[model samples]
Target: MAQFYRLRVHHRQTGEIHDLTVASDRYILHQAEHQGYELPFSCRNGACTSCAVRIRSGEVFQPEAVGLSQELRDRGYALLCVSYARSDLEVETQDEDEVYELQFGRYFGGGRVRFGLPLEDD
Candidate 1:
């Protein structure tokens, strides 16, 4: 039998709060979209941070969320496109830039050099 859980989403950009029921086996973003709530998303395959959210309470399983590191997942970050509700969930939508920064900001503007390029010699 499939289990259903209450999902509360707080949209930071629009200041909207959405309450919905989601099946444990379904993706939250997909469920939200089905119910006519427009959420921010770029890639629906969990390859980007456009659908990132922070888990305020409860748990989610997102084994396919490659956009987020394990460290960030441990810190309660999840990609809604690939996440499954493990229990009743409360999540706050995150800014795309904020989540991107949290994921790869350290590697940016660090004075790193490219090894293989047209203008550079190997």
Candidate 2:
């Protein structure tokens, strides 16, 4: 039988709660996906820090880490895609609105152009 884990993610801005149940071996990103939560992430591996987040409570186990700084890990920051819950967890992170805005800035907004075409704007 597969073990079950409970997750409670708190959106820091709106104070919305996402309660989830996932297989013990499953990463938090999968749980977020199952719940239709648009979590910010890039590489599914621990290479990019885009999935970085702070744990408000409980603990997670990570067998491998390529991006997380030691200071962050000490302070409870984790890469959700490669971390497993060690207990019922409460995580705090920037809200969906901020993630959406970040996505827009990366894909469609002029933030990219401003950084790229300095001569055009100046």
Candidate 3:
């Protein structure tokens, strides 16, 4: 028998809170959509931050969530598209750009860019 868990999602943009009952075997995002909640999401394959959320309470398992780094996951970040509830959960939606920056921001503005072709100093 499949176990179901209660999920509380707080939308950061609109301050809307959605309550849902999700099966442990299903992805949280998919289940939310199936229940008529319009949550933010892009890639449903766990390859993007569009469905990122921060675990506020309880736990989720997302071993296939490649969009998140171990550090981020340790910091309570999760990709709803690939996450399965391990227990009753409370998550807050994260801004995509914010999570993206946290994931790859270090690489930005760290290298020198040569606008034109490099001139050979003969």
Q: TM per model?
A: 0.89, 0.69, 0.88
lDDT of each: 0.92, 0.73, 0.93
- Which portions of model 2 miss their true places by more than 4 Å? 13-15, 94-122
Of the pair 1 and 2, which is ahead by lDDT? 1
**How far out, in Å, is residue 53 in model 1?**
0.1
Q: What would the per-residue lDDT of candidate 3 be over residues 20-74, giving only the tens digit for each residue?
A: 9999998999999999999999989999999999999999999999989999999
Cα deviation in Å at residue 111, candidate 1?
6.7
Query: Distance from true position, residue 117, model 2, in Å?
Result: 15
- Which candidate has the top score in lDDT? 3
Against the hidden true structure, what lDDT does model 1 obtain? Answer: 0.92
Residue-wise C-alpha lDDT for candidate 1, range 19-105, written one tens digit per residue: 999999889899999999999999999999999999999999999998889999999999999999999999999999998888787
The residue ranges of model 3 lying beyond 4 angstroms of the native Cα positions read: 109-122
Span of ten consecutive residues with least summed lDDT in model 2:
95-104
